[model samples]
Target: MLSRGGAVENDRGSFREFVEKQKQKGTLVLLKKPCSLSLELAGVMKALDGKPVYCDKIKEVPGARVAGNVFCTRELICEYFGIRNEELMPKLVHAINNPSKPELVEGKNAPVLEVTEQEVDLSKFPIPFHAPKDGGPYFASAVGIANDKEYGRNCSFHRMMVIGKDRVAVRILPRHLEEFIKRAEGELEVAFVVGAPINVLLAAAISVEIGKDELQIANSLAPLRTVRLESGIEVPADAEYVFEGRITSEMVDEGPFVDLTETYDIVRKQRVMKITKVHHRKNPIFHVLLPGALEHKLLMGMPREPTIFNEVGKVAECKGVNITPGGCSWLHAVVAVRKKKDDDGKNAIEAAFRGHKSLKHVVVVDEDIDIYDPESVEWAIATRVQADKRLVIKHNEKGSSLDPSADPNTYATTKMGVDATKPLVAHGKNFEKAEWKAIKKEEYV
Candidate 1:
């Protein structure tokens, strides 16, 4: 039953190309079970444990099939960017700093416009209910696209909850989209792109200077081809689904939705999006992102790695960075550096905090330690850190709003950093882990 939708021949720029590439690599999983959008969050979360595989087999929603966990791991992201695992952060930082302009094509040539809904109805798609606290079924995988005459075009992920057949309540933070909406006199033209390519998704999440077009960043990672909508908004030509809409002046209660911190965000009056035109490819596979899951954490955290790396580079030879899932991948970070001076660890800790202001705690480790491995990072902290000498703390710092402990009104909290790098006097020999001689496992078995 799950194997019904075979490979859809795709152009070079379509998201289906990436899916087909992953499928060819044997990393895509097709689930055959029919699942309720609200009830299946846990099942999808469980299926993505420690692996980044594409899963499809949702049949519960009307007029759609659903898939999830498209960018859950570094390996998958590296695959999409055509880079090696170790080159991920540097490459991202470079691409973000230097972006390529996007190429635009006519709307009639786009696959997303292959079918257009005469009447705008969002309920026809299986936008998942990710958590019990969520107010309604929300579009968790959407990368919203909007344009400003000055800013050109902007793409970012904004949670949209389906409130009516053609209405969605969008949680708009003070960013490019909000700025663009403010620039627009009445209603802001927008496009909620579902199932965008991996590059586009990452580009949307990055924090860049205002007036910087994220589509160009997507093009820097890979050549991004866009199609002009009837509304004049440009979207990735190969997106699975595109909802051309407008951000209206009307406001609605839009929260209690799970955030990146895996906490229920309080309800707030947010702007509403009135979808005008719904366009999609034939037999489109709906992309659903489980809120507060690994997918959410990775997408939110990985983009920050470059910022942290670039900041720490000024003070030390920054090796790598890992935003731990335990820290909600937003409020905590682990930075690895090749210790040159005795204070390089401490310097890196301060630099990292500066890189991401929302960080509440940071741990700096030696080059020998693997930042991705929690146990290794913990070991470095245990063996090398002296609380009185290595600890750095700041009071009443601006922090993540998702942190339950922070003052919600001000988004302020205490922040700390730990210098877990070994002393320079030791010459690193004493800190090395004991290793066993290599042997053939086949012989022993």
Candidate 2:
């Protein structure tokens, strides 16, 4: 997180700075109307289609404000990082491969611990009910920070449903957090941080090797200053609300909430967390993430882009990679490559599948094709692709659990890869589009 301009230039130090920058850029939409966490706010997010917004008034939960659409688009991410979106993958790849350790500071110096409440009450915060059929108000943007003595620190996102005043039912997937908690004797010390930096959020979402510190990756992306909580767990110093808690050896009903696939996930008995202390700044803003919306999709999908790029780079000169919005940014992808040989496209397609195991469909195209544009990718597939020669299908492969078409029991689905690159030969020029004379816009008008 190097400063770009000068002393006054925005280095995106904290989530507050990021929001302020968005406000100045006229990209942060302020919704002043009294909003409800139940459906009103979620409805607004759906209507905006992941437009960055700031809400000053929450009717249901008084004195609590919120911000959303933080990770809406690649351009928005580019603006935050002060780089072109085209450079994002390379930057993330570098950060993931070569991580920088974070500096641990005292909680006294952190703004998040400015006000600490010993009497923990989850209802005090404006935790939004994102989906219509959700069990209760969920902290979807809450990034959980946990540590094991042997395994070290772990940062990851988990959905926490407000079941009681100090109790939250968390849907703990079988990941690093789950593994950390399992290794513990009784309860695992955890800190659920809200309104952390975008870089921290992205780092938490990525799946690094077990025992690897995701915080280090975050520090590589941007300086991630952490503070020790009362529970001895470390969390982002600039977080809006830091709920020091422990994952109790208790199971509770969670979910039936909308998942990444924009469908209701099955209700299950999940782990319960007992929040012991709540720390916050003077006036905190809750970062809300709409379930199954663009924010959720991007946060879950974009981290994989860099991994895909790195994997494809091993085999081909990968130009760009885009996780299509239409595919929920998880089940599908489009990879652009500077095709040196006829097999470059096919190699990239296979490498992409390896990069992202959940990917169900992939399209590999020439560098001339705009991977971001569905129309352009489709054109390449229509003109350059042959069903028999270009299509590669792998059936019964382990895919995303969110994919409804996949076997729910096994999470197995068929994966397809389409090599849409033109044949590399003397007659390859035949596939090029006919040249049209360039016209001046003013003259044409």
Candidate 3:
């Protein structure tokens, strides 16, 4: 996390004060007075156990409210991108629509003072243990940078789990970075980061189309942010925690705990890494992610939003999606769409499956319905849908790895979809859209 900032009169970048200063305006919910993250970490443990309370000292840092709950809500995500939550999609579509080249700055030193190429230590910093069953402390969240084998461009956000003080497991999908790692002869360059421009982490989460470098989409999200290759690592000038390492073919047991899907997964062999260098600002904040939390769902599933929106748009006036927590945030998705035809709901079901190949089940609702409201969606299915007509595919489709009922080794299971939308042309022919009686203004008052 060697951040390099330039002064008005100098081409040489100056090392910024600390991680708290690099944050957007005021996101540092820090207690200037000394308090151990160890104490706060214990509090987080209890909070997840249904008892949450933060140190009263933290209440002093301007907008420094409690940071225990999800630090990655939709509102928080939008604020990070400098956009309204409602504008997230169009902004995403816009960025994907108009990609730009990232500005690169090269210098010996940056706000990221020294690289710390040698004499690296994992201790001496604040790293939280987000979950009880985690292998060990996780240093960074929402980041892991790897250069592509097809092209030397960097692809980031493949999570890294701490195995020990000097080791980590680089989690990668078989066909993904695994392919890149293989192409590179099983020797891969990796950098674990705590924070970046925020936009870069979003794009790198899911590189939907090939060759559309996330760095390109990142530059489109915020101004004054530049992308550069430094000391063989791709990074933002103000990144919080950065560690340089190498992912090798050496395998180790990766997990036996809950995932973003919020369900426990069987431990399996995953690639291991040896840390070579550790870089960060003074008194750096080490972020930890709970196995299954709001932040986890957003990081693991939200990136799939644009793909779903794009696919569903072809079939219906699709608005957005919310992966219900009850369904482990991965097995099921509730899509919101405006029915253009009688079968528009069914069309949306097909699109959702295409967007996320692992989706086990999908429920499509009308625009007037609230997808986030369980009762609202149930009402639509109960009143507008006929089980026989609305229910779409129910056959052997790919099953989610998170579904405990499904055999992860074989991935054998069925996928189901329900089309819950009001019939456009019912017993009446050429009917106009339904309208309700207008209510008196301020009637409740």
Candidate 4:
């Protein structure tokens, strides 16, 4: 475990600082060989999908580096926050419930403003063409930050494809960013932040009420500082790169890219954004998040855990929630609860779906079962579940579009909920597993 002072030093939300710390811990793989931005960079990253990797040499951009899989697992994220696995739920819930505003600093104080680009050419950076089927070189990790008169400030992730020297097509869903664009009459000044801290990235993916600033939640998670761009858009002061732009009314094709399900998403006409200015720290490290990979899944799914915990707590004592990776971390979840009544598991299943609307299947188990372990969850199902009595199925429900089996047009599919909690009163068989005392086998040998 890291000391309190160490956590404080790294809690300011600096991506470069986090990378250096990982390197010092001997967990980061340093690749000194020159690599291409086309496919080689992403290919290497995919090959080492669950490990942190840093590429120091880039063929396209001199003095630029790329880092991937920095936060690919829950253990890495927990370590970054200086917390244990069990504490993550409460920490996120507290941060969301009590948000604090970040300290605003001038451009001179912000390290990201140390260098300003004379011309806006995105190709000069290390943006990777992840796969052959991708429409274009994509920026899968950039967080789009925009301000709204009615909703204050909003931050969300948008996959961007480089279309020209100074333009990119962004896939904007019907979320806060779209609302902000609509309020501004189809054009809004925005900032795309690359290489943000883990706290900021996690907070941006959280689905909170409108008018609630995600940056504030990030600040509550850790000490964070913000700097305003020339367009008056605020971004993390310690970010590696900040692209100031305007999401224009123009629409263009965007997709054939891999999504959360590791499947190709259909092409759609999305909004185009024109970059007006670019700011970065000296020798900035670009963050490349491979689509449908571990890092992507964790970022998209972990934030939803707190929401599920909150909803499940209303009816049962929610112990833990795991958005299992096998479900692509979006469509399936395993929830552990301390059952107080016969229907607690079933109630938790219903509430879990309510917490994450895109969830297609859910399993509710007792506290004894480890929600994070696939085999443990299956064991609970095998021992405690009876399909006729414990299964809850909803037909023709709105599900995730990432599920290829669902109707692509409506995202409609059948949802299943399995109550795999053991009965409070066992009829004949013992629900608890047998235990024994520990001994040192070396003495006997």
Candidate 5:
């Protein structure tokens, strides 16, 4: 959904191109389902299905496509941002801290009101049943365009549940739309736009402490982006659909299903709103995100990575960071650094915790080791890490409420960090890689 100059791709590719690329890569699997909505189908799909395969077109949302595994893998995320996997974090951080504000353009065909549906019905949209315990159909792909309290314009992503024909339960967080909601004191005006551009969706999904109005960040990410809309709702003009709505104080049961971290979460008693209207194009295409899939983690985790990088940069030459898979996209953090001082690791540890607040385990390693490599990081810790000198463990630290293990509604649990960089020593066998030879790909492949 390009909003300004031309039809710039929201991501590296278009919705059609995405399918083509997946086809070329021989990655996407085709399946035939009759708009399956059974609770068991969703569970089976998650438990048994492979990576980002297309569900083809569902009967309910005709001409619409649903793809999962969007961010479950690094290659997919790299594809989305048009960068190498190694460059994903830095690119995201750069884009987040220095986002370009959206430019308004005159357009009567603005998606928010274009073919606006007056007789709204949530059931008409292909809302998926992610889990058996899930309360209702969820629009996992929708982008919640939140109105900033201080600035009156900002947008973020929060899971919304279709509680009614004209309403949904919005899940906004402190660093995201929830912050704006509080600024408006319980009742916040918002625009819930679904069937989004992939890049715009990603920009909203993988963002950090960025100011209100991330459409600009998304636009800058896709330099050729052309956004044009005059209805006060700042969004890509080419996006398939955009609906203006509000988050109300009305509360309802939210969830008791599995989350992105691959954990069964019990999100009970949440605020739900009544949907007033919906807008979409004729035979508009609908998109759904795989709840708790790679794309979900990437979109959710990558943005937070920048937050950690910014905070840790103050203390060390933090090069890059990644939230490991074992951490379920929220629990663990792996930070790559060019350690300048002996205490750089500790500073990074504190900065990481401070940056994310919910991080439990942090590992700081030299740039030589791949933070994404479990074995490599383990080797660094085994050889260079010293518990007495490098390990920093603090009790009763803040943690994630999404973490069922953590004591919720209270203080954070114990968190720890290991400086996996080799100790700077002259001759004490302090830190050195054991003898190993690099092998050529031809020898193995």
Candidate 6:
């Protein structure tokens, strides 16, 4: 286990503190060259997809800084939470199960409210034009927080495209935010927070009940403080930037942006948001999440791991779950379980699908197999799996929108589950791998 002591322990829920820790550890890359918001900054971000990057010289926005790939990998996320890889699922599950309210601070003491501009101009910030096919400069890292009369409050990620000085076309899915908008009669007040802490970011991406507040889950993960905006929308007090906005009845075409699968999403008429105010801390750092990149995939997929683990646990003694990045971290997953019966693997497969509706493929392995290692999982599949008996397939199933091969209109695809667990009783062939005792190489040499 990694050490849980030091600066990280002291500043567990502070985004700036985490960045500074990464800098001290030499894991964060600093870009001294001036970069442009139009493709160049995103290009650099993509080029270094799995490493934390910071750039202070923005050609478009003077005195502004941008950071990317901060939590791009599972290891980085674990480091942020001061946990090991094996502990992630339990931590997430605990947070989801036991959510606690965050402390509310006044606007006067909130760091985010240090600078507030009533006359909003989004173009003045360092929003990125990620790819050539993108509709416009996007705030891909923004987590929108909105409240409803019935649902109370909802926090979720909404990709927004800058359309004017104070307006943005936001892609609103038929989820909690949409429900909140409808409840508010097609106009809902929202606060889009950028450069939030890892706990808040992970909690926002989680799919919970509509009325359940994600900020509470974030607080459970780590102590969180929030400040209520003038619009009555509460946001993280330590966030880099907060855009006080309203999702209006007006709509505009908003897409051609890269999705989780690195494919261009089709244009659709989306809701328009009018930013009434903008607030940021001194020397604010913008979070630049390049569309369809590792950071994007992890944020979208990691939260689903706990759900899959929970469902699989109902059927079998679940050991671990890995949403592989090779599957775009959305469509494919590997589950490890302590197989008690011959049918436990199959039962786990069914439960895993029930856990995450968007999962297209899953492989069930014995507890001995390391689900995190692709080679180990492949070895298990090759050795233990007999396609004729262990393969389970479902045709024309509802799948993820990120998968390009799925039906464009319906998003339906074929799903497969492989029971790769070894039989309890080996009849003719040995299923276990032969291992030698541990040896000291240095002594032998």
Best by lDDT: 4
**lDDT by residue for model 6 (1-445), tens:** 2134344555636778888889999999999899999999989999999999999999989998888999999888888777887888899999999999998999997999999898887878999998998999999999999988877889999999999999999998889999989988999889999999989999999998889999999998878889988888889998999999889999999998988888899899999999999999998999888888899999988999999999999999999899999888899999999988889999999999999999999999998898889999999999998899999999999987777888988999999999999998889888888999999999988
Give model 6's clash tally: 0
Off by over 4 Å in 1: 1-13, 24-26, 45-63, 427-429, 434-445
**Between candidates 1 and 4, the lDDT winner:** 4
Candidate 4 Cα lDDT to native: 0.91
Instruction: Report the candidate with higher lDDT, 2 versus 4.
Output: 4
* TM-score of each model, in listed order: 0.92, 0.96, 0.81, 0.97, 0.86, 0.97
- Total residue pair clashes for candidate 1: 0
Q: Which stretches of candidate 2 lie over 4 Å from their true place?
A: 1-12, 426-429
Which 10 consecutive positions of candidate 6 have the poorest summed lDDT? 1-10
Per-residue C-alpha lDDT of model 1 across residues 1-445, encoded as one tens digit per residue:
1111222343354567666666777777755555667657446655565554443444565456665777777877776665678988887888898999877877777788889996987767777777777898888889999888877888899999999999999998888889889889757999999988878888999988888888899888777778988778889987899988889989999888878877789999999999988999988877777777777888898899899999999999998998888998898999999988988988898899888878899999988998888999999988887799999999998888789999989988999999998888986357777799999999998
Give me candidate 3's TM-score against the actual structure: 0.81
For every model shown, the clashing-pair count is 0, 0, 7, 0, 20, 0
Q: In candidate 5, residue 341 scores what lDDT?
A: 79
Error of 3 at 161 (Å): 3.1
How many collisions between residues are there in candidate 4?
0
lDDT of 4 by residue, 1-445 (tens): 2233345453465888888889989899998778898889888888899999999788888878889999998888888777888988799999999999999999899999999996999888999998889899999999999999878999999999999999999999888999999999999999999999988999999999988999999988877899988788899999999999899999999988888888888899999999988999998999999998899999999999999999999999999999989999898999999999999999999999999999999999999998988999999999899899999999999978678999989989999999999998898888887798899999999
Model 3, 208: alpha-carbon shift in Å?
A: 1.1
lDDT of 5: 0.68
The residue pairs in collision within model 2 are none
Pairs with backbone N, CA or C atoms under 3 Å apart (clashes), candidate 3: 2-112, 3-110, 3-111, 3-112, 4-110, 4-111, 15-111
